[model samples]
Structure formats: C-alpha cells, structure tokens
Target chain A: DNCRCAQCVNQDTLQRNFDTFAIPKDLSPQEISPKNDGVDVLWSDSHKSHYPWSWLSLTLRDISHKKLANQEKLWGATIASAPPEVRFDDVMSSTSPKGLADLTSKIRQYGLCFVTDSPKTPEATEKLLETIGPIRNTHYGGFYDFIPDLALADTAYTNLALPAHTDTTYFTEPAGLQAFHLLSHTPPANKPADEVLGGQSLLVDGFHAAETLRKESPGDFEILRKVKLPWHASGNQGVAIAPDMAYPVIETNGGNLHRIRWNNDDRGVVPTDIDVDAWYQAARKWDEILKSKESEFWFQLEPGRVLIFDNWRVLHGRSAFEGLRRICGAYISRDDFISRWKMTNFPREDVIASNMQLR
Target chain B: DNCRCAQCVNQDTLQRNFDTFAIPKDLSPQEISPKNDGVDVLWSDSHKSHYPWSWLSLTLRDISHKKLANQEKLWGATIASAPPEVRFDDVMSSTSPKGLADLTSKIRQYGLCFVTDSPKTPEATEKLLETIGPIRNTHYGGFYDFIPDLALADTAYTNLALPAHTDTTYFTEPAGLQAFHLLSHTPPANKPADEVLGGQSLLVDGFHAAETLRKESPGDFEILRKVKLPWHASGNQGVAIAPDMAYPVIETNGGNLHRIRWNNDDRGVVPTDIDVDAWYQAARKWDEILKSKESEFWFQLEPGRVLIFDNWRVLHGRSAFEGLRRICGAYISRDDFISRWKMTNFPREDVIASNMQLR
Candidate 1:
C-alpha cells in the first residue's frame, strides 16, 4: 500500500477511497504549524499528518519563487577592452578545477580570449581545446591546418585583405567557438615591401558595436534585428553543397543578444520587397560602427599562440599578407561550450529547473 | 537617371524628379494589353511603355497568381511502406543530372532511402556521399568507423537494444542526414546454439506517428508540441564534450512539420510545476504510438549497403544483438541537404522570393 502521509496520498484518490470524514472532506489542514524540520497538520478527520520540510521545499520551490535572474553586462565601443589572456600551458596542465572554471568564466564574460606559448602543433591545440570541450568538426576537418592555397574553395584560404565578418554565416547553425593557432609565419619568398607589413589579425566586438548602435540609432538597430538577409556560399567546384541561409543580421532571444551574422562577401541577392535604400543606409551605419577603431582589437598573431573566441559575438578578419603562414584551428559547437560552463559552475538541478521554467 | 518603369523606379524619388503630370502622377495603366511577348502599358501621362512579358510576368506574378503549392504526403502505419531505393553505383557513376535529382527528390518526399550495391568500403560510402554533398564532420569526425569495443564511451558502440530515437538530439542543431554503412558482421564467440539472431536496424516515421496522434488524441499531441523537454548527454566518461538542449518533442514552422526530437534515454529531469501524472500519461501514449508495428520498419542492413535518412523525420534504432558488428557512418548538416535539393530542383529566385513573402 502507498504511504498514507498527506503529501504522499493523492487527495482525489483518497476522497474516493474513504468516507468523507475518515480522510477529511477537505484535506486542507484545519491547523498547520511548523515543528522540528516538519509541519504538523491537524485535519477535520481528527487525524494528523507530519510532512518533512525537505520534501515540501522541493515540491513548492518552483511555484512559490520566481526564476533566478542574471542581467547580461552589455559593452559599447568606448567600454571595449582587450580580452583577458591565460598562459596556454596553464590551461593545458592545470589540474585544479578552479583554473578551468576561471577560464570558462572569462570566456562567458568577455566572449574572447588568448592563450600564449602553446606548442606549435595541431594536436597540442586540439588537446587544449579538449580541456574546455570537444572540437566541433565542420566541413573543414577537426583541428584543420590552414595555408595559402590557390585552389582553395573558400576566401579564408587566400592571402587577401579580408573584411570584418563572422565565419560560416551561411550555415544555419554556425560554429560556436573558433580556435586559431599560428603554427608558423615566414616572410614570403618574393614579397612586396608594402605587403610584408600587412596580414595582421583583426577582432571586433560585434556585441559592443550592436549595443552602441541600439542606443545611438534605434531605427537602424531595429531594421538589422528584424530584416532577414540572404547569405550564400557556392559549393566547391565539382562539389554539390552550395548552402544558402537567411537570418536577421542581429538576433535576440528573451531580450538578450543571441547572435550577429555579417559577411559582406558572402551576401546573396537582397529581397526585392524591402526598401533597398533604407536597408543600405542601415547596413552602412552598422558597418561603420563595426570597423571603427573604438570597437576593434588589432594584433599580429605570432607562432606558438592561439586565439579562441565566441563566433556568435565576435567578428574576425585579417589584413592582406604576403608571407608563408601556417595556421591550425578547430570549431566548437555552442552547446558543448555552454555545457562545460554549466558543469564547471552551476548546479545541475538548478540549471535544469531554471531552463524548464524559462521555456 | 533611373529607369522610369513603374516597377523599376523608386516612387519617393521619382516624385521629386518630375512635375506631377510630366512623369504621370499615377502610373496606373489606362489600357493594359498583351502584344507579342510584351505588355503595352498606356499611362495617364499619354506615355506608352512596352514591357516584355517576361519582365512583367516576374514582377506581376505575385499579384496575378498564387504560388505553386505542393502538399507534403504524410503516411501512417498502414500507408507506410519501405522507402524507395536506388543503386549506389547508379548514383556514383551516372553522368546524367537526373540521377542525383531523383535521389534528392526521393529523400525530400520520403524521409529515408537506401542505396543498394554499395562497395563494402568506407571510402566508397564517402565518395557516394560526396556525389550528393560534402560530408558534415561532427565530434565523431568526418567519417567514423564503429566496432564493438568494451571500452566504448557511447552506448551506440555496444551491442545493446536502442530505443527508437533521433541522433544528437542534445545538440542545439542536431545533425540533418545520418548515413550508415554496415561493413561487416560476425557471430559472437560465445553464442548459444539456440540464439542465432538479433541486430536488425529499426526505423519509425516520427512524423507519421505524430500526425496520427494529432488526429486520435489532440490533447496529448498538443502537450507534446507545446512542452519543451530538456535533453542531455553526459560527457563520454573521460571525454569533455557533453551537450544539453531543450526543444519541444514536435516542432513546426508556418504549420509545416520542421523537426522531431525524442530520446527517452537522453531525457533530463522533468520540471516540478507540470502535472507529473498527466505528462507521464501523454509521454506513454506517444511512446506506444512510436513503437507500434504500424509506424515501424524493421530490416537487416547487410554489408555492402548504405542507409541515409533525415534525422528530423525518421527515428532510428536497433535490436539487441549477440555478435561482432562493424559499421561506418557520418552526419550531414540539414542546410547542405536542403541546398542540394534546391539546386537540383527549385529555382533559387523563386525560393528566395517565396521565403521573403512568407516572413
């Protein structure tokens, strides 16, 4: 037989099983008072039931309380700063749980980070990535090495002056964490003097730029947030995987900035129904904000250094280079990075309960 | 100077360029008649603009006609049958575009398909996949080989009965196409004389089951469609990649079935606020429909054959087996498969315009 405690028995089932007064027509307690770690319930049936506070607390917490709220700290161009850095070896070799927790926390706060003195090998970069989460294998193989190849299918494989953009914008779900390691950089054999000075890596805090735009020009920001622009990448010659996707330039979920997708080069035909002139004006303003020095972090990646950042929040680019550069990198899915963060910090029960309520 | 055609010119700018009557205050046609492959537009300004029918057709098609509509064929247990199949060699070696078009069309029409006579090699399977699209690399790699290893981290690598479910449901965007190629199978070393069976692949048309439930039990179907359930997979023991995601069991976009996520094994803790008994009853009913013979297709996958199916519509599983089985497989992103389908059939302009209007 099931336990007869008031908390364990279903009131409706009990009403059917017994006479009205035997189980109490109204199971609502006639008198209730807190005891030592329990509640004493005096029923109309002249029967009493004792309920432990632990069970009551667990069962009533969701209905009795609001979800825990954490406001995301939004930054602007003037407020932008360099991402916090950690030694590559410290992240790879640290056995202390606090070290990993600190790294993941920094990633969540700053959307970008740098690790120096990493071993100049793809395997080393991959091993370091594992400390955070699994490598997200994409069309580009996991832990892929990049070198200038004339036969490259993507623009990233060339030595051109790239503009600020997010990688794989054409992908419905773009890679989350992009990790780049500069394995080697040798001056080009027949390099032009002017070209030798270029090829520096560029980083832009898209979130900061977006937040600034939202405050400065709400109309432009709203257009970018609502208008869906088409993005496309041609399948490699002789290959049959030409992907095309359309999404708002700025995306939000529950009033929180979710993602930013911008790639002028990969952009496809604009829809004819939208006001082309208005769209252009809004897009230009956004581009100006994205490229402004206040929103940019420029640095030349040296050998044995790796850069990892949130692909959704940060836009990456590189100036033209005339050099023999060898780089290795990998992509991590967003869910994996978030999972690692939750496991390192939040309690599993709390995370699940909060997400359930939000949904 | 801008084109003066009503369709091409910007109305706001045009008003400023010319006097009201000079350019025609209202370009509404006085007499619109079709000539030889052209339309004669007699404007109120006494200006006649001869517009080619093709241009007029493309521009006026929206107002003049309804879009092409194709109803998706949904099948249930009795109506369900084995998916239409093609030979692997025909897909790989055929020079005709029709071959690939037929395959992709079949996939779109029926959520699953099998290619017979595939060479018993991982490379062959990959080559055939490349014929349709690039391989979608995942945590498992570009192409992964599976063999029974006692130390395997995932349950899929072991010889256990798998419940009908979609793969990678815990990922924010689950893989689109799952391709499986059975490489080899050997009887277990300790097999009993009477136990000479098992290890057949199982598939269920999740969309069919959902639609059936929608008709038979609207309340249960509604709950499944509206309730967001948390899904989680513990990082493989010793591995660092664990993913957690929440999505409704049944999802739709613009009244079209978009995705189905169900995995009892990967389901996380249910929320406390929901009626536990009611949810359990609804879930049990769904499971019953999913497992019913009417919705299931059972078959033994032999070596030298590959099965490819949509992860969004078809749920895959396997019966417990006592034998040595080796399999190789890879996941293709949904965007890629859709891209291939569109390229092989639908015109890009038509698709974009339709999507824009829908939004």
Candidate 2:
C-alpha cells in the first residue's frame, strides 16, 4: 500500500503516548482479579464514534485530537518502554516475593495475558512486541505491512465487529500470542470499547466450538477434510497474497481446545464441491455463536494497556465503534511467548488465554 | 483475456480450426509415438525466429511480416497435428498414424503435447489454451494485457515461487495442468538487446534433483523438513498465497525418483542449523542438470502442433532473453489429463514436448 503511515513520523510520538495509558512501572504478568466472579473490562470515551452504524461516529472523528492529547499525557515520550509481560486475571497477583514465579507457571498452562497501562499508538505497538521478545513477521500473501493499510485503517477495519476468531489457523503453525495496545477508546472514556456499543472480545474455548461441530456436523466437516479449495488473488494493487494452503477451517487435538480459524472474506469457494448449502449452514451456526454479545467480555483497552490473546484458543474481536479508532498490535509465536514467560519464572495456567475463557 | 478472436465471431471457422488441432482426429494415442500424449499443445513455424535472443532484445520493435512470409515457405503450412495424451519419446515419424497415437499417450501421462507450422502470435496463443480445455482466468498481474492496460499481463500479485511449484498451489486443492503455447520462439532470429542476455526454456527434474540430494546431503535435506522460511511480495497488486503446508525441495517416496521443487528466487535463506552453503552447492549442481541440454529436449513449438508437460513433475524455464517474447498459456489439472489418458491407455514415461526441426 502506498499509504503515508508506512513512514509516518508521528509513529514515535504515538507509541510514547500509549505507554502512559494504565500499566504499572515494573512489568510482570499479574492476575488483576482472580478471585472475582467475573472479569471486568471498560472502554474509553473516544472509542464509540468510528462505526458506520454509530450515532457517536461524528463525535469520535471530531475529537481525534483530544484523544491523542490524553494519550500523550499518559504515555512517556518513548514507545519502546513497553514492559515484557503481563497477567490478565488474579492468577499472579500474589504480594509475595514468589509472585513472578507463580506467574510463570500460569503462562505455561495458558497461552495469553493482559498487561495494563500500555500506550495505544502504532509506535507503541511496535515497542510492545520488541520489549516482549522477537516478533514473527507476517507474510500477508507476498509482501507484509506491519501496520494496517490505509484503506483498511480508514474504515476502522479494526473496529469492524470481528467474530470470535484466531489470526492464522490456516498457517502450519499460527503466530502464537497477539498483543493489542489500546491508545484511545471511543466511549465511557475509561471503559472497555465493547461497553460503548454491543461489542465484546469473544473467546470461544475453541475446544467448545470444535467439540460441538464434531458432534453436530461431522458429515459436513468431512467435506472440508477431503476438499482443497483454490484461493488466489491476481496482483491486486501491487500486493500478491499467495494462494491459500489446504488447511481446514477447524483443526483439533487431544488437548482441551481445538484451533478454529475462519475468515469468511478470505475463504475461497471450493470449486469442485456439489451443493455446499448444507455445509455453509452448519458453519454459519458456529459463526453465530462467536458474534453474539453474550459470549464476549467487554473492556476498554485504555492507553498504557495491552491485551495479549492466544491465536489458537482465545478468539478475540472488537465491537462497533465511532471515531478514529486505533489499537496497535504485535504477534509472537506461542513457543516464544512461553519461553519468555518461563525464563522470567512466571509460569501458571491463569496467564493462559484458554485457562479461564472456556468451560 | 477478453481480447476478440475469430472463435467469438465464427464458430464454424473456430470449429474447423479446432478440428484440425483436435486430438485423435488424425491418429490414436497408441498409434502415436510414445502414445498417450496430447490435449493442450501446439507448435508452429510462424512463431519461429532466426534469432531468439535477438527477439528478446527487440521488445520495442516489430518484425517485418515479409520476413515471416519467407520463413513460412521453408516450414510448410500446417506442418503436423497431434491428438490428446501426447508424449515426447514416442513420435517417430510425422506422417505415421502411430506417431499421433504415441504422442497422445505421452500427453495422457504428461499433461501437454506439441505440433509444428502453427501461428505464434498473441491471438493464436490465447486461442490455443482456450481450445485445449478450460481457461483459468488470472486477473492482471504484469502477464496479460488487460482492458485499458497494455504491455503488461498481470494477475494476483502472489509472489514467492511455490515448491511443488504448481499453478494455484496455495489453493487448499490445486488448480489443474497448465499449458504454455509458445507463440514466438525468436531464437534462430536475433539475440536480446539487454546488458544481461539468456532466455532459454529450462526444465529441472525435481525427482532427479531430490534423489541426488538425499543420497549426498541428507542432513541438509532433513533440515529443510523442519525449518519454515518466510516469503512474500507486494507492490501495486495483492495476492495472498498463504498455505499451511510446505514440502522439502526434494521428496522421496516409493520410487527412487526424487521430486524436485526449486524456486531459487522465492525461497527464504536457509536456517543456521542447516548447512545452507553446502546445500546450495548441491542444489546448484541440480540446477546445472536442469539447464543441461541432455536433460532438456528442445524444439521450437509451432503452429497446428502443440506441447504440454506435467506442471508437477516437470519444472520449466527459459533462457532469459531481450525483446518481446510471447507465449499464451492455460492450465488443466492432472485429473483432467488422467481422465483422458484412461480413456485410451497409459503409455511410457508419459507425454512431453513438440514438433520437428533441423536436428
């Protein structure tokens, strides 16, 4: 993409702003509310205006500058200051000297964590990935872009309500954990973005989606097992996304969760199949569960805060929003994330994405 | 691809022309040399050039039709034709009925065939793929001349030569066999006009390359099995050829024949654990074999006759040249070729490339 942001000078300033959003100075995975009956997430005020369906859309666009102002106040002048690790639940909140040790245990069992008070700009996103460890660069077809392309960003393509989905289930080994730094939110200024609208960060214990599908649509699923759909994009705007690999939409293992991957837009139609109506219908049900609000947790990922989810088990998504929505993201493979967590002596199941998100 | 051709306007003329090129019309696959050859193929005298390297250098210039007229007499009009499922080692004599049958049988196993005294223009190339089977449409990708865009026929910008190196390899299942109708073999014409010159059709047998590698560099070959390399391309086009599967450059099965897939430009650098330098040396030797005249049997594929090859087994290339070189290609899967081969009977090492020449 010939977008301006690829070389945007504002990148550094933006990342610095994200560092001040909400996290503590010292970084380590710590469970925020392990004993609580439920998880709590809030959205910021500027988060709700960017959606096409939102009445607050204009408000978000109008206050874009103000949001950045708040961002600047919280994040430091440097984006690379992001901490190495974070804990989402109360799994590692122990005040004892062994807190870090307990956290390491949790991370190994689970596969994700949430860190607070991280900056939310693109610059901050890069910094977060850097501090944590080596990040796996993507192959978006042939060429890759670290930040979202302009058209993709302008539409708040990120803001579009994404269903419960993993990032690259289609890959032989999907990028493991993904981190999103929220620099600005649309509504309830300090609340999670989902709270501003009917949005939520949905994690379908892929375990559940898999078991359910296996029992309910075994026959239909078999079609995928035997089929190879040709997926290709003839050079489109100087980007060559390689053709699709023969991965199934749903993959399983003996473990608690099976990796579920489905991006409808990216799903190339199977050319040789006969009467795919039933298969689509069966697949639709699984999608419906993912999109429903009841299944997702809502929390405005504020500035200085980052949420990392397992691409395999924790399916993450966003809700409808208004304004210039922005959240910077970085990806780390599961093995690397785990290695980092353990090296820091913070292993525990609570730090994992599937540990608490599923039944 | 939307270019106007006589077929769109005149079905009779198209059919008449098609009938002349039709397989088994004049002979059976068994009767042809190395039977079971033929389907998508063509060879012509019109496309032959006094200097191929010169043709590449003549990109900006057009050739005089008078010169072509003179060459036409040397190579008789409608030199020869072939039937479906053609092979290379089979065609003994052009006039023999058994010649076409043998050629057809070869194509049955191989996927393509060849002929002589055919047209070598773009219009002729397009018609050839259209006539053989189905035309798999590719969007503009610097390859085809799209509407409002000339000089570049581009398609899905998916880059990174895929190992297993088949067209649409990224598809969960792949697309069929591809046929390249060489419309102009300007070799014997003129050389390229560039600083670097060499555009010769090169074929690398993966099976042979793999066999040698396994026997000589097993560890290096083994390293490729575990390591995943990153590859991509993007600029004014978008093609996502992401697949979850990857195979080593050399694969050995029950047959000692090693399957080779070497896309020198697309593969990422080898990992440290692997003896990349040594592996490259061995691989280079394999490449040399691919470029070897003995391994490659060549002839200017011309007019009424066509040539086809199995995209899976036969890796093809050309000695890069300067100027405007035109070849029209279309794809058909192995299954399609197989279906036709079964209609007759499998024969020899299978069908291969085209017509007669000075040799």
Candidate 3:
C-alpha cells in the first residue's frame, strides 16, 4: 500500500514531475545540534583544542546532472529511486519466498532497495541481518539513530554536519552494502507546522564517479600512490574505528573503484605530499558531481520500510528535516548478496521488465 | 686531525665514558612542559586540549662498539667510535696540494671523512648544500636554526629528545646523502654548567640492520606493507610530513639494504589487518636483533666535522644531554652522488665502502 511506483502512483503522472534532480554537494548529517546549526561529538574535545580555525574552510559543492532520469540511455542518473513494484517469491508461507529473492534482485540491479512492513528497532535490524547473512560493521560514527539527540549539545557527544563521502576508503578491503531504518526523528527546528516536511535520503554512485575520474585524468588518479590522508572516529571511548595507519581515500584496482573512510567528521588532516594533492583534488571534483541536485533522489522511508544498498557503488546521506528521525544499519559482503540472488535464478531482469511496462 | 679511527682510539686507549643505549618508552619531551604534551603544531587548537601527554615516548640508550674490538669479525663495530673529519675547499689553501687528493680518496674509500681547521659556522654547512648542486627538502617541514626560540618549542623547534630512527623514511623518493652541522647549541638546561658535558650523536648503518633483517627473518621484513604506521611532523605551515610510507624501516632492494625512518616516535599506530599484525610481529622480531648491543656503531660529532653518510643505509639519532643542541643539515640526492662518483673515476668500492663487512 505504501509503494507509489508507476502502477501505484501512476508513473506517467509523476513522470511529468520526474525531471531528474542534480546531486547534492553537502550531506545533512543526522543533526549536530537539536537546533540544526552544528554538532559537538566526543572527538570534538581533541578537535576543538588542537586544530586551528584556518582549517574550517570547508568546500562541498554539487555537480549533479539534470539532462535525464538515470534510466535514460547514456544520460540516465540512477535507477535507485523507490522501486516500481514489490517483488515476491510467494511459494512458502513461512517467508516471502519471493520477498528474499526479490530484495536480492533489486539490490543487484539498482544497487539499492527499500523494505516496508518491518520493525524499526536495532534489534529488528540485527534480526533482519540474520535473515540476510553476515553484516560487516562499517558505520563511521554509530548505528545512527538519525533522529535528533537533544541531550548532548556541542559538547562532543552532540552530532555535527558531515561532508558527502564513501565509507572505509582507507581500508585494504572495505565493508560492502549498508542498510538503514529510521526509528525516530524530531521534525526540523524552523519548519512551519503545516509545511509538507520530509527527510529525503540521498545516494550517489561512486562506481560511476571513479570511471569519470579515470576518463578525465589518469595521471591525476595515479597521485594516490604518494598520498596518505588522515581519518579518525575516536570521539567516544566505546567505539574508535578508523584504519590503523595513514591510507589513501580513493583507490583503483583493475578498473574497479575501492574507497576507504570518507566521512568528514572522521577525517584528521590531509597529507602534505604535493604528488598526493592532485588526487585529493580529483576526489573532490568527483564528489562535486555527486553533490549536484539533479543527480540525487529520495523516497520517504517511513517505518516498516528498510532500504538495503550496495555500499561500494552507492553513497548515502540524509536530508534536513523535522520530526524525530532514527535509522539503524547493518552490512553484508557482496559475495553473499550475489549468491542470494543467484540462488533465485536472478530475477532482477524480471522485476525491471514488469516495472518497465508500468512506466 | 679531527678523525680518530682505529689507530686513534683503540680499546686500551678508548674513552669508555660513552656507550650505546636504547630509548625508553615513558620519557617526556625534554623541551615541552608536561601541560602541553600533545600540543603539536599541526593539530587544530580544539583537538590538543584533550591529550595531556605528548604523543611521543622517548629513550636514550648509549651506542658505542668498543666492546666488540677483540672480535675481528666485528671490525665493522670497531670503527663505530672513529672521529669524523671535515675539509673546506677555501680553508685548504694553506695546506699542500697533496692534501686535497688524499682526503678525497679517503672519503671515496671510507664513505666518510673528517675535515679540520676549516671554516666552522652554520653558513659553512649551508654552502656545502649549494656546492652539492641542489638541496631537496625531503620533508616540507622548514629548516630551523638549531637554536630555535623556546616559544617555538610548541612548534617542534626546541631541545627535544628524538627517537632512534633514520631520516626520509616517510619519503617515497628520498634525498640521497645528508650533512647536519652543529650550527648553534648552548649548554644543557638546569645543568647550565654541564652545557659542554654532553650532547653526543649516534649513527648506525641502515645497511647493517637491513641485511640482518633480510638474513634472519624475511617474512617479518615483508610485514611493513600491512603496517603503514602512522606518522606526522607538521611544524611548518600547511605541511604534514609522514616519514614512513612505502619504504620499510628495514628493506632490501637491488641486493642492497635500504632504510628510511627509524624512530618509533614518528611511526604512529600499526595497521589492523591480520597481515599487518603478522608483519608487525616480524619487524619486532628482527628489531630484537637490530637492538642487540653487537650490531650497532655509535659516535658523536665535533664542530667542522661534516658527517656524510648514505641516507638510504644509515639510521641516526642523538644522545640528549646538557644545554640546547643545534645542528644544520644539507641533503644531496643519491643520484647526484652516484653520478659525481662515477664521473670522477671515484672507485665505487672506495668513496664510502659499507661498514657492513661479512661478520
């Protein structure tokens, strides 16, 4: 009942409002302050005392395209908006025999998918992970509640704004795929009571951006060899996760894009090697493209809906909003997802076919 | 007249006062107050407030090899206490023409020579850099007068204790050979009268330890790839230098031993990957051998003594003591040294024969 795909929302009707949006340059983090200006997290204690104000000049701008929907030939942006329909494997009464098969297919095809009619707690998320397989922990900060935390103001425990970036860009093998379910979020601070409020989640395909970086500047990409950027997430005592040593944020292996930690809140400092500066610039340029508004998208993920995404190709972030917002996440390896999909004869093409007619 | 080689300082006549020693794990920075321990110059102001301890742990162990003189097998260690001799071109005018060629041959054969009765000043060392063709700032960290202001102590410009390590470990393409002159150093702190009492220097053949690491445990030697240890030196504005990246503390390349940084101070956290852990264990195992009293050669430098050695195969540090220690350094690319040595028919076996004799 919640899906409003081509058949449900009548794709033809919204196809009129379907002008592709540009990718966003900046990602609105869950919330830095209850008021929404900034955040103060655990590392903030060390961050505030050691770094100078000169380092605060942040530059995150958008460069997303608006020429066509991602599905368009050659010019499409992303096929990862709300799915066109609910896929089913309804043979067994115990589970959506087709549901597992369909969910696996959607992730394989579009790199991400939304789930509805599920519990919204961390415990439920963990249970869901059991059904899916193994989940790797790649969260930079936490199993984000995404909901605003009013208790810890800018005291380092309070959250803050973050730049849009890939996760674990510094690791030799980064964790793949991410799932987030919002349990609670207070509405934004300044919104009008009657205004149509929403928390739009944003996803950028890093796989595509890596290709763009390669095509435009191979020499620049090679700069990653001499560079070692810093990243940190040791704000709290309970959790301190980041690569053990300095590592590159952008990596290329056999033409495939591999990323390490890219969350700005976790970054320490950029290296001083001149050879490395160019690659950081290249990474920034690629990020700028993802920042474009036209290349971005969203569908309100209300409770009972869980979105599973390929952590490698697809980058994720959230929109500024009012209302209590909460999201819990779990991770699984790519091999697991691929095997799950192959077990069901790969029905990604079928779902695309059914949705194509509705469009 | 400056150098005191085998004939100059024998076991029976050796000044048994100074010996080789290791750095301890809990020593405080000799320059900074306990209050600003973690107050590194590169960190944001806010970040420094939390960490009260300096990021570094220092030790001061002696490095004299007089004890090995009896073992002909340790002829290499016998010369550890050899005095360094330096010669200045203009200053040599008063001497016989035979002096120039004789000293040049000594340098070519021994890889180091002592020049005495030469102009002794910071500028004299700076001039040596100019004569060497080009001076490469391996690390962007600006050169400081050995007598840096006390306030600049917070900026890595003071009488600080350095860890046992080599230079250019952080460099992907390191400078070749270097010369650091004692430009300005006053007496030791508190022990104002003890100013001239201490401040001896230490040097070890990176070639020596590297060969040992290779022969003893090649598996541990390969662990460096997994342990891209963290390092930082950003006293200079807009500069963050990492002294250990691609090169290992002990490496074997082209049938020759190569080493970069040796100080555990700059080499921060070890990587978390299993391979990294394994490599860490291997390097540590080899280090046990490297730290053995038998393998090290140590000595101190007198003014006007230009100590030149291959940065690729030498690890150097200091035995911190009374008064402030000051030194000026100039670097020459290994390529230039090689080119010049080859052009002049400088016997490759002579200019700087390895102290690494088969023992």
User: Which candidate ranks first by TM-score, i.e. highest?
Assistant: 1
Kindly report the docking quality category of candidate 3: incorrect
Q: Give the DockQ of candidate 3.
A: 0.01
Kindly report which residue stretches of model 3 are placed more than 4 angstroms away from their true locations once superposed.
Answer: A1-98, A117-125, A135-146, A150-162, A168-174, A184-193, A224-226, A238-240, A333-359, B1-359
Q: What are the clashing pairs of model 1?
A: B77-B294
Against the hidden reference, what TM-scores do the models get? 0.75, 0.36, 0.38
Candidate 1 per-residue lDDT over residues B1-359, each given as its tens digit: 11235543223211112222124323566888778967777767667666656444544454311332334556554533455788886777666666666677777777877888889999888888776665765445567787876454456766878778898776778778898998988777777656756898888888888888888998988888877766655534322232333477898764657789887655544565577556666777888888888887888888886999889888999999877888988887787777666556655444433332322
Per-prediction DockQ, in order?
0.14, 0.02, 0.01
Task: Evaluate fnat for each of the predicted models and list the values in order.
Answer: 0.13, 0.00, 0.00
Put down candidate 3 lDDT per residue, B1-359, tens digits, no spaces.
Answer: 10113322222212111111111223233332234433332122121222223112210111111211111111234566664354577325444434444443344444445565545676666655444333543222223345545433122243444334565443433545667677555664566553464556666555556556666776766664224443333232222333212234554333433344554433433433346447546656655655566655566666766666666555566655556657776665454444343323333222111110101
Tens-digit per-residue lDDT, B254-344, candidate 2: 2333233444433322433456455555455555544454445333434345556556556655443444445555554333333233222
TM-score of 3: 0.38
Ranking by DockQ: 1, 2, 3
What are the lDDT figures for the candidates, one per model? 0.67, 0.38, 0.44
lDDT of 3: 0.44
Per-residue lDDT, model 1, residue B316, is 93
Clashes of each: 1, 223, 118
Comparing chain B with the reference, what is the TM-score for each candidate?
Answer: 0.78, 0.49, 0.61
